[model samples]
Target: MLTFSIFAVLIGLLAINVPVVAAIGLTSVIFFALLGQGSFLAMLPHRMYFGTTGFTLLAIPFFILAGNLMNTGGITRRIFRFAGAMVGHIPGGLGQVNIVASVIFSGMSGSAVADAAGLGQIEHKAMVDDGYDPVVSASLVAASSVIGPVIPPSIPFVLYGAITGVSVARLFMAGFLPGIIMSLGMMAALAVLAKRRNYPCSACRTPAREAWASFRGAFWALMAPVIIIGGIMTGFFTPTEASVAVCIYAAILGFAYRDLKLRDLPGILFASLHQSVSLLFIIAAANFFGWLIIHQKIPDKIIAGLVALGASQAHVLLIMMAVVLLLGCFIEGNAIFLITLPIFMPVAKIFGIDLINFGVVMTLLIMIGNLTPPVGMCLFAVDSYAKVGILPLSREVLPYLAVIFAVTLLIAFVPGIALFLPRLVMGGM
Candidate 1:
C-alpha cells in the first residue's frame, strides 16, 4: 500500500505540473509522513548530501563548464564550418551539416539541451536561411540533439555510472556505435525529406582546400573529445580528473583563439552553476525517493509480479523498456533515471543481461523522450531557433523519431552495438 501510495502521489504531482525535483522530494516526504516516521525526516538531508557526494559526480559540473567555455570560445562556429564543409554538398545540404555537426559536438557538450541551445541555434538558423522550413529546421535540430547524450562524455552515462557502480570509462566507449547508428539513421531520414521537399543544396561540393581550412580551424575543438576519452581509457586520469583536464584544455584553447576573454570566465562559471544546481537538486530528491522505494522492497514486488506473468527474460526486458519509454513521455530524462534505475537495475541482473548494455539502451530510449510531444525539452529548447509552436515542432519530428526508435531497438537486441568497444578496451563485460 505504501509503495502504491508513493507512486500515486508522484504521478499526481507530475500530472498537475509540479517541477520534477519537487514532485520527487514531495513523494519521499509524503511517504514518511504517512508512515508516521517522524524520525526518518531528519535523515533526509543526509541522504541528499550523500547522493551528491560521489567523486565521480564532480565530472558533471566540470563537463558543463567545459561545454560552456567551448561555446563561448567560438568552438561551435568552427565545428559547424567544418561540418558544413564536409557534408553541405550532400543531397540534404546544410541539413546534413546540422546532423554531422551534432555528431561532432556530441563529443563535447554531452547534454542534449546544451547542444540544442548552443550549437543548435547556429544549425537552425543556417538551415532556415538555406531555404529550409522553420518548423522542419527546428525539428531537425531537436531530433539530432538527441545524439548529444548518445555519444561519449554523456551526462546521462555519468549519472548512470555514479548510480550503478558501472565504469564511466566503459560507458563512454560503449556509446560510440549507438551514436553513429543514430547519426546515420537521422541522416537517412533527412535525405528522404530533402528529396521529397526539394530543399536547396548549400553547395555543390566544398573545395578540397576549403575543407582542409575548416578542419584546421576546428582542430582543437575536435581534439577535445580525443583528449578526454583518451585520458580516461589510458588510465592517465579518472573520469573526474578527465573532466577537470578537459576544462583546462578548453580554457587554453579559448584564450588561444581569442574567443573567450577573461571576463567571460565568471559568466561561464555561473551558467554552469545554474545548470549544475538544477540537476543536483533532482539528484538529491531522487536519492531520497530511491531510498523510500528500496525500503518498501518495491523492486522485489515488481520482480515478483513480472515473474508471475511467466515471461522469458527477453520478454521481461522488452516490457520494462516499454514502461520506461512511456514514463519518459512525461518525466524528464534525469528524473526518469533516478526513479526507475533503482527498480530496474536489479531486474537486469535477475535476467542475466549486461548492465552496461542495458544502460546504453535505456539512455537511448530515454533520450527519445526528449524529442516527443508536450514535455520534450529539446523541442522547447530549439523552438527559439524556428519561431514555431511546440505542437508543430513535435509533429515535424515524427520521421526522425522513427529513425531514433529503430536504432534504439537495434541496440536493444544486439548488445554488441553498445558493448563491443567496452569489451575490447576493458577486456570483458
Candidate 2:
C-alpha cells in the first residue's frame, strides 16, 4: 500500500505539471520524511551525482547531438529522396515513401520526434503537393515515427540496456526483425488505403540512373547506422564510443553536403545541449527516486501482490505492458522506462521472463505512446510540420497504431521474433 501510494503521489505531482526533476526528487524526499528516515535527505545529493557518473551514459548526449545534426543537415532530405525513388512507384506513392524514409532514418536517429520533425516537413509537402490528404500525411508520419526507436541504433534500447543490464548489442540485433515487421505492416495497410482512396502512384519504374543516383547520394548518410552498428557488433566500439563517432560522422556529412554552415552549428549544439540536460536531469532524479523505492523493497511487495493474484509469467507481462501503455500516454517515454523498470524487473524475475525480450517489448510500448493522444510528441511534431489538426491525425493513426501494438504483443509472447537475430549472430538466447 505504501509502495502504491508513492506512485500516486509521484503521478499526481506529474499530472499537475511539475517539472519531472522536481516531481521525482520531491517524491523521494517526501517519502523519506513520511517513512521517518529523515537522514535519507542527506544522502540525496550524493545519490543524484552518483547516478549521473556512469560512463555508459555518455552515449545519450552524443546520440541526441547526432540526431539534431542530421535533422538540421542535408541528410534527412537525401534519405527521403532515396526512399522515394525506391518506393514512390508503389500505390499511394509518397505514403510508402514516408514509411520507408522513417525506417531508414530510424536506423540513424533512434528517436520518433527527430523523424517526425526532421523528415516531416519534406514528406508532408511532397504528399500534399502530390494530392494526398493532410490528415493521412500527418497521421502516417506520426504512426511511422514509432519505428524510430524499434530499429537498430535505438536510443531507447540504450536506455533500457543501461537500466536493466541487458546487452545493448543483443538489443540492437533484436530490433532487426521487429523493425521489418513494423515496416511491412504499415506498408501493407498503406497499399489498401491507396487503392481505397485512389492515391496517386508513379505509373512507371524509377529510371535506373535515378535510383542509382539516389542510393549513391545517400550512401554516406546511410552508412551512419551501418558503421555504428557494425562497430558495436564487431566489438570495435562500445555504444558510447559509437555515439561519439556518429556525431563526428554526422558533422562531416553536414559540411560535405553543403547544407550546414559553420554559423549554424551553435544552434544545433544548443538544441542538443538543452535536450540532453533535461533528459539527464530526469535520469538523475529518477535514479534517486528509484533507489528509495528499491531500498523500501516496494518491488517485492508488488511482486507478492501479483503472485497472490495467481499471475503467470505471461499474465504478469501483459499486466505490466498494460500499465506501461497507460503510463506512456501520460509521461515521457524514457522517464516511463526509468520509473517503471525498477518495479517491473523484479516482477519479471519472479515470473521467469527473459530480460532482452522484456527490453524490446517495453521500448515498443513506450514509443507507441508517442503516437497517442493529448501528449503524443510525434503527433505534435507532425501537426507543427504539416499544420494538420491533431484530432484527425489521431483518428487516422489508429489502424497503424493498432497493428504495431498487436505486433508488439506478438513479440512479447513469442520472444523469438526479437531474440532470433541475436541468437543467430551473438549465439545466446
Candidate 3:
C-alpha cells in the first residue's frame, strides 16, 4: 500500500509538471513525513552521494565531455562525410547517411542527447538541404540517436553494471551485435520509406576514390570506437579509462583537423559540465527514491505477488517490459533504470534469470524510452537542434520505433542475440 501510494504521489507530481529530480526527491520526503519517519530525511544526502560515487559512474561525465568535444571539434562532420560517401546512394540518400553516422557516433558518445544534439544537427541540415522533408529528416535523426546507448560505452549500461555487479565489459560486448542489427533494421525501414516517398538517392554509390578520400579524412575519428573497445577487449583499460583515453583522442583529432581552438575549450567544458551535472543530479535523486522503494520491501512484495499469481519467468519479464515501455513514454530513461532496477533485479534473480541478458534488454528498453513521446529525450533534442516541431517529429518517428521495439523483443526472447559475444569471449553466461 505504501509503495502504491508513493508511486501515486510521484505520478501526480509529474502530471502537474514537477521536475523529475524534484518529484523523486520530494516524494521520498513527503512519504517519510506522512509515515512519521521524518528523521530518516537526514540520510538522504548520504544515499544520494553513495549512489553517484561508484567508480563506473566516473565514466558518465567523461563520455558526455568526449561527445561535446567531438561535436565542437568537428568530428561529427567528418563522420557524416564518411558515412555519406559510403551509403548516400542507397534509396534513402542522406537518410541512410543519418543512420550510418549515428551508428558510428554511438561508439564515441554513449549518449542519445549527444548524438541528437551534435551529429543530428549536421545530419538534419544536410538532409534538408538535399531536399529530404524536414519532418522525416528530423524523425530519422531522432530515432537513430537511440542507438548510441544500445551500443558499447553506454551510460545506462554503466549504471546497470554498477547496480547489478555485472561486468561492464561483457555488457559492452553483448551490445555489439544487437547494435548492428538496429542499424540494419533502421536502414531497411528507411529504404522502404525513401523509395515510397520518392526521397532523393544518388545515381550510384560513391566512387572508390572519393570513398577512400572521405575515409582518410575520417580515419582518426573512426578510431575512437576501435581504441575504446580494443582496450576493453585486451584488458588494457577499464571502461572508465577507456572514456578518458577517448576524450584525449577526440581532442587530438580536433587539433589535427585544425577545427578546434584553445578558445573553444572553456565553452565546451562548461557545456559538458552543465550536462554532466543535470544527469548526475537525476541519478542522485533517483537513488534516494530507489532507496525508499527498497526500504519499503517493494521488491519482496513484487516477487511474492508474482509467485502468488503463478507467473512464469516469461510472464514476469513481459510484465516488467510492458511497465518500462509505458512509463518510458513519460519518464526519462536513466531515472526509469534506477527506479526499476531495484524492483526488477530482485524479481529477475528470484526467477533464475541472467543479469547480463536482463541488463542488455533493460538498456535497450531505456533506449526506446528515449525515442518515445511526452518525455522522449532524443525527440526533443532533435527537434530543438533541427527546429522540427514535436507533433510531426512524433508522428514520423512511429515506424522506426516499431523497428527498434521489434528488435528489443527479439533480444528479450532470444537471449543469445545479446549474450553471444559475451559468452563467446568471456566464456560465461
Candidate 4:
C-alpha cells in the first residue's frame, strides 16, 4: 500500500508537470510521513550532500567546461575538416560528414547535447546549401549526437559507476566496441538512405595528403580521449584527475590556436556550473526516493514477484528495456537514469547479470531516449539550432532509429560486444 501510494503520488506530480527533482522529493517526504518515520527527514540533507559531493562526479563539470572551451577554441571545425576529408566523397556528402564528426567528437566530449549544439550549425547549413532536406539534416545530426555518451570518458558511465559501485575504468573500456558499433550502424543506415535519394557527393575527393594534413591539425584534439582512457586504464589517474587533464589539454589547444579567449572562460564556467547543479539536484532527490524504496523493501518485493512469475534473466531485461523506451518518450534522459538505475540495479543483480554489461545497455537505452520525442535533449538542441519541428524530425529519424534499435538488441543479447574490450584491456572484468 505504501509503495503504491508513493508511485501514485509520483505519477500524479509528473502528470501535472512538476519538475522531476521536486516530484521525487515531495513523494519521498510523503512516504516517510505516512510511515510515521519522522527521523527519515533528517536523512534528506545527508543524502543530498553525498549525492553531489563525490570526487568522480567532479569530472562532469570539468568535462563540460573543457567541451565548451574546445568549442570556443575551434576544435569542432578541425574535427569537421578531418571528417570531411575522410567521408565527404560518399553519397550525401555533408550528411556522412555529420556522422563521422559525431564519431570523432564523441571521443572528445561525451555529451550528446553538447555535440548537437556545437556541431549542428555547420553540418545543418552545409547540408541545406548542398540540396539536402533541412529536416533530414537536423534529424541525422540529432541521431548521430547520441554517440557522445556511448564513447569513452562517458558521463553516463561515470554516473553508473557512482550509483552501482562498478569500476569506472572497466565501464569506459566496455563502451568502446558498442560505441563503434553504433557509429557503424548509423553510417550504414545513412548510406542506404543516401543511395535511395541519390544525394550529391563531394566535388573534390580529398587526396590522402589533404586527409593527413587535416588529421595533423586535429591531432591534439584526437589525443584527448587516448590520454583520458589510457590514463584511467594505466592507473595513472582517477576519472577526476583525467577531467583535469582534459581541461589542461583544452586550454593549451585553445590558447595556442588563439581560438578560446580569456573572456570566454566566465561564460564556460557558468554553463558548466548550471548543468552540474541541475544534474546533482535531480540525483540527490532520486537518492532520497531510493532510500524510501529501501526502507519499504520495494525492490525485494518486486524481485520476489518476478521470481514467482518464473521470469528468466533475458525476460527481465526485455521488460526493463521496454519500460526504458516508453519512459524515454516522456521524461528527460538524466531524470530517467537517476530514477530507474536504483530500481533496476537491485533486480538485475538478483539474476546474476554482470553490472558492466548492464551499464552498457542502460547507456544505450538512455541515448536512444535522447532521440525520442517531448524531452529528447539532443532533439531539442538540434531543432532549436536548425529551426526544425519535432514531428518532422521524428519522422525523418525513424529509419535511423530502427537501425539503432537493432544494434541495441544485439548488444543486449551478446554481452561480449559490450564487455570484451573492457575485459581484454583491463585484464578481465
Candidate 5:
C-alpha cells in the first residue's frame, strides 16, 4: 500500500506538470509521513548534500566545462572539416559527415543534446543545400547524437557509476566497443538507405593533400578522448582527476589555437555551473527518494514478488528494459536514470549481472528514448535546429532506430562486446 501510494503521488504530480525533482521530493516526504516516520524528513538535507558531494561527482562539472570550452574555442569547425574530408565522397556525403562528426564529438562532449546542437547546425544546412530531405537530415542528426553518451567521458556513465557503486573507469572502457559497433551499424544502415534512394554523392573528391591537412588540424581535438581514456586505463589518474586534466588540456588547446578567448571564461563557467546545479539537484532529490525505497525494503519485496511470478533474471531484465523504453518516451534521460537505476541495480545484482555491462546496456536503452517521441531531447534539439516537426522527424528516424535496436540487442546478449575492452585494459573484471 505504501509503495502504491508512492507511485500514485509521483505519477499524479507528474501528470499535473510538476517538475520531476519537486515531485520526487514531495512524494518521498509523503511516503515517510504516512509510514509514521516523519523524523526521516530531518535527514533530507544530509542525503541531498552527500549525494552531490562525491569526489566522482566533481567530474560532471569539469566535463561540462571542458565541452563548453571546446565549443567556444572553435573545435567544432575543425572536427567538421576532418569529417568532411573523410566521408564527403560517399553517397549522402554530408549525412555521412554528420555521423562521423557525431562519433568524434561524442568522445569530447559525452552529450547528445550538445552533439545535436553543435554538429546539427553544420550538417543540417549542408544536407539541405545538397538536396537531402530536411526531415531525414534532422532525424539522422538526432539519432547520431546518441553516440555521445556511448563514447568515453559519458555523463550518463558517471551518474550510473555514482548511483550503482560501479567503477566509472571500467564503465568508460566498457563503452568503447559497443559505441563503435553502434556507429558502424548506423553507417551501414545509412548506406543501404542511400543506395535505395540513389542519394547524390559529393561532386568532387577532397584532394589528398587537403584531406591530410584537415586531419592534421583536427588531430589535437581528436586526441582529447584518447588522453582521458588512456590515462584512466593506465592508472595514471582517477576519473575525477582525468576530468580535471581534460579541462586543463582543453583550456591549453583553446588558448594555443587562439579559439578560446579571455572573455569566454565567464560564460563557460556560468553555463557549466547552471547545468551542474540543475543535474545535482535531481541527483539529491533522487538520493532521498532512493532512501525511502530502502527504508521500505522495496528491492527485497520486488525480488520476492518476481520469484513468486516465476520470472528468470533475463525475463526481469527484458521487462525492465521495456519499461525504461516506454518511460524514455515521456521523461528526460537523467530523470529516468536517477529514478529507476536505484530500483533496478539491486535487481540486476540478484541476477549475477556485471554492473559494468548493465551500465552500458542501460545507457544505450536510455539513448533510444532520446530518439523516440514527446520528450526525446535529441529529437527536439535536432528538429528545433532544423525547423522541422517531431512527427515528420520520427518517420525519417525509422531506419536509424532499427539499426540502434539491433546494436542494443547485440550488447544485451553478448556481454563481451561491452566487457572485452574493459577487461583487457583493467586486467580482468
Candidate 6:
C-alpha cells in the first residue's frame, strides 16, 4: 500500500509539471515518513553523493564536454556535409542525410538531445530549405536523434554499467549492430516515404572530389569514435580515460578547425557544467528513490507476481518493453533508467535474460520515448529548435516510431542482433 501511494504521488507530481528530481526526492521522503523511518532522511545526502561518485560517472561530464566541443568546433557540419555527399542523391535526399549524419554524430555526442538540438538545426534547415515541410523536417530530426544513445560511447550505457556492474565495453560493443540496423531501418523507411511523397533527391551525385574533400574536412570528427572505442577495447584506457582523451582531442580539433576559440571555452565549459549537474542530480534523487524500492523488496514482489502469473521470458520482456515505452512518454529517458532499472534487473536475471541484450533493447526503447509526445526530450528539443509544433510533429514521427519498434522487437526476439558483436569482440556474452 505504501509503495502504491508513493507511486501515486510520483505520477501526480509529474502530471503537475514538477521537476523530476524534486518529485522523486519528495516521493521518497514522504514514503519514508509514512513508514515511520523518518531517520532515513538523515542519510539522503550520503545516498545522493554515493550515487554520483562512481568513477564511471566521471565519464559523463567528459563525454558531455567532448560532445559540446565537437558541436561548437564545426564537427557536426563537416559530418553533415560528408553524409550529404555520400547519400544526398538517395530517395529521401536531405532526410537520408539526417539519419546518416545522426549516426555519425552519435559517435561524438552519445546524446539524442545533442544530436537533435545540435545536428538537428543543420539538418532541419537543409530539409526545409529544400522544400520539405517544417514538421516533417523536425520529425525526422527527432526520430534520427534516437540513434545517438544506441551507438558507442552512450551515456545511458555508461549509467547502466555503473548501476549494474555490467561491463561498459561489452555494452558498447552490443550497441554496434543494433545501432546500424536502426540507422538502416530509418533510411529504408525514409526511402519508401520519399518515393510515395515525391520528395526531391539531390540535384546531382556528389562528385568524387567533393565527397573526398568533405570526408577530409571531417577526418578528425570522424575518428573520435574509432579512437575512443579502440582505446577502451585495447586496454589503453578505461572509459573514463577515453572520455578525457576525447575531450582533449575535441579541444585540439576545435582550435585547429578555428571554430572554437579561447573566448568560447568559458561558454562551452559552463554549458557542459550545467548539463552535467542536471544529470547528476537526477541520478542522485533517483538513487534515493531506488534505495527505498529495494529496501521495500519491490523487485522481489514484482518477480514473484510475474512468476505467479506464469509469465515466460518472452512475455516478461514484451511486457517490460511496453511498460518502459509508456513510461518514456511521461518521463525523461535517464530518469526512467535510474528509477526502473533496479526494479527490473533482478526479474530479468530470474528469466535468464542477457543483460547486454537487455541493455541495448532497454536503451533503444527509452530513446524512442524521447521521440514520443508530451514530455519527450528529443521531441521537445527538436520542436524548440525547429519551431515544429507538437501535434504535427508527433503525427509525422509515427512511421519512424513504427520502424524503431519493429527493429526493437527484432532485437528482442533475436538476441544475437545485439549480442553478436559483443560476443565476438569480448569472446563471451
lDDT of 5 at 53: 84
Off-target runs (Cα >4 Å) in candidate 2 are: none
**Candidate 2 clashing pairs, residues 3+ apart or interchain:** none
What lDDT does each candidate get? 0.89, 0.88, 0.90, 0.85, 0.86, 0.91
**Comparing 1 and 3 by lDDT, which wins?**
3
- Residues 15-60 of candidate 5 have per-residue lDDT tens digits of 7889889998999998899889999899999998888988888888
Q: Cα deviation of 351 in candidate 2 (Å)?
A: 0.9
Clashing pairs in 1: none
- Candidate 2 residue lDDT tens string, 1-429: 797789899899989999778988999999999999989889888888877777778888998899999988899999999998998998879999999999998888888888888888888888889888889888888888889889988889888888888888899899888988988999999899899989888887799999999999999999998998899888999988998999999999999999989999999999999988988899889898889989999899988888788988878888899999998787888889889888888989889898998988998898788888767888998898688788888899998998899889899999988999899888956
Candidate 4 C-alpha lDDT tens digits along 264-301:
88898888889888988898888888878887888888
Q: What is the Å distance of residue 398 in model 1 from its true position?
A: 0.9
Candidate 5 — what's its lDDT? 0.86
Write one digit per residue (lDDT tens) for candidate 1, span 286-375: 999899888878889888887798878889779878988888789989889999989998888987888898889889988889988678
Clashes of 2: 0
**TM-score of predicted structure 1:** 0.98
Alpha carbon RMSD to native, model 1: 1.2
Question: What digit string (tens of lDDT, one per residue) describes model 6 on residues 1-429?
Answer: 655677789989999999999999999998899889999999999999999999999999998998888889888899999999999999999999999999998887788888888889999999999999899899999999999999988999999999899999899889989999999999999999999999988878999999999989988889999999999888899888888999999999989999889999999999999999999999999999999999999989888889999999999999889889988989998999998898889999999899989999999899889878798898888888788689899899999999888989999999987888877877855
TM-score result, candidate 3? 0.98
- Give me the displacement of residue 73 in model 6, in angstroms: 0.4
For residue 185, give model 2's deviation from the true position in Å.
0.5
Candidate 3 local lDDT, residue 288: 88
- Give the lowest summed-lDDT range of ten residues in model 1: 1-10
Write down the worst ten-residue block by lDDT for model 5. Answer: 1-10
